[model samples]
Target: MKAISLLGVGICGGALIAAGCRKTNFVDKMAFKSAINNYYSTRQDCVWPSPVKFPVQADTSNYEQTKGYDALTDTGFLVRKAAEKKRFLIGSKQVNDYDLSDKGRSSWTAEQTQPGYGNFCFGHREVTTIDGFSPADVSDATQYSVSYHYDVAGVPGWASTVEMKTAFPGVAMDMSGQQSAVANVVKSDSGWQVNSVTPTD
Candidate 1:
């Protein structure tokens, strides 16, 4: 079984776990599932409204070696490095996902910033979680759900949150402005890399 150390999600404890039926001993851990949502975006295309402090290459001009990455631009640079090979694009279609409550959100905010993600995202209609892997594997999968987190080496902007906006027009109204999308991730030398946040084709 492969093991992974989560860079984001600065919670208490040595580590967390979320195994499937094969290892059904659900602890007070966390996980993610999917659904169409109207959160974290500005465009009506299920794409995140590339934040004003969007993570990118330009932000790494003078990475204060002292701060060790304690600013918005630092984070943008890190995300850019992780996503070096991709752009926002959905890799899978089958609806599936995850999310945290206001309280949970508070938990992450209070203690951690940028809930680091290896793959899994807390909320979305298309990003699904794969189950039944080993404890290490399962935990690794759940850890991936979070997008960014503090304490994770090389990961910046650990204290940022994505605002919600919608995409996908009139086919169904009422849930306007809300947004959701499939998170595209790539395998990296260090680990998984997420780049493009694309939509269904």
Candidate 2:
């Protein structure tokens, strides 16, 4: 009877250990997904100049005395100017044209910071959707490997104009498409953090 009881206890202990491991893995997987989502959301706000050009009239008279003043042109110009100014103001927080927010900045690797590494220099990216998150391969208690798909629509900054493009041929202009990539998430002192992302052809 004593031996049987000991065996039963061992089996129960083993079962408990297995359950704990599964719970940990689930938590890690969610954490990784959250991290990736946060990263994509952060890039949604990129710095870019206005796309509209304002009209300039050479009339310095009363409000109704200007013959060449077009309201549409003036409105468009104001909107564009405001957008451009906002982009310039946000440039201080960007690196390699990517907006790495205060928390997300830690994930940037040296390769991403090198000159001419990213696609857009001064523009905002809109991640329309994210799907196809594969089952995470838990490497261990603290590391996980995963793959996912996402779509983005990007608008180039005013600097990406034809003249600017001619002068700086290497700069990337407006871009929109879907792409897949693999990422590694590791549990750091702060929390679960994405270590790297590699594009899959």
Candidate 3:
């Protein structure tokens, strides 16, 4: 009778272990981190022509436009020079002409559809910590608002310059170290997957 009781206990223990293993779904921190990192892998930092063509020119009077170019020039990604070019009918005017430097050409990803337009991509994000989550419901939880910290991975020197950070707020934010973000994750058949992530306000 004692041997039979021991066998029964063993069976019960096995069942409990199986049940514990089955509980590792979306609520698990490791699972959430994996999903968030996977989502971020597809997002890259890029600088594209806002509404103009490359090999472009911006009037010196246009500080907003010239500042952006000056920042990129500081990173050696773009070459800029002063010139006097003719306007529509305003005669010649002072402008800053910009073209891609050798470094920029190397990292440039040409747009497939738009022949002369492209962007310079820097890096993607990676999860640093899983801070907290909401809707603690485990049994029937279909979605979660996960607060977490993240950092930019594979950032390049050219994209980390003071000028680059100053000109591009996004770049500065990404490099600012251990930034917090909120990600919405939804339950799927396989597991919990990240729906979207946004910076924490």
RMSD of each candidate relative to the true structure: 24.3, 16.1, 5.9
Choose the strongest candidate by TM-score. Answer: 3
What C-alpha lDDT values do all the predictions have?
Answer: 0.27, 0.43, 0.82
- Cα displacement (angstroms), candidate 2, residue 163, comes to 15
Q: What is the lDDT of candidate 3?
A: 0.82
Tens digit per residue, CA lDDT, model 2, 1-201 = 999999999999899988774544444445666777666555542222212111222223333322212221222222112111124555522111112233222322223444422221343333333343444444356765567664444433343445444433323232324556677767789887777777674
Backbone Cα, N, C clashes tallied per candidate: 43, 0, 0
Tell me how far the alpha carbon of residue 29 in candidate 1 is from the true structure, in angstroms, after superposition: 12
lDDT tens readout by residue for model 3, 60-84: 9988778878888887878998899
Which portions of model 2 miss their true places by more than 4 Å? 1-30, 40-140, 153-177
Clashing pairs in 3: none
Model 2 clashes, total count:
0
Two-way TM-score contest, 1 vs 3, winner: 3
Query: Residue-wise lDDT of candidate 1 within 48-154, one digit each (tens)?
Result: 22212212232233333212222222333222232122235845222111233333233232213323421111222322223222233443343232231111111
lDDT of 2: 0.43
- For model 2, what is the alpha-carbon lDDT of residue 161? 48
Candidate 1 lDDT for residue 159: 28
Model 2 alpha-carbon miss at residue 55, Å: 23
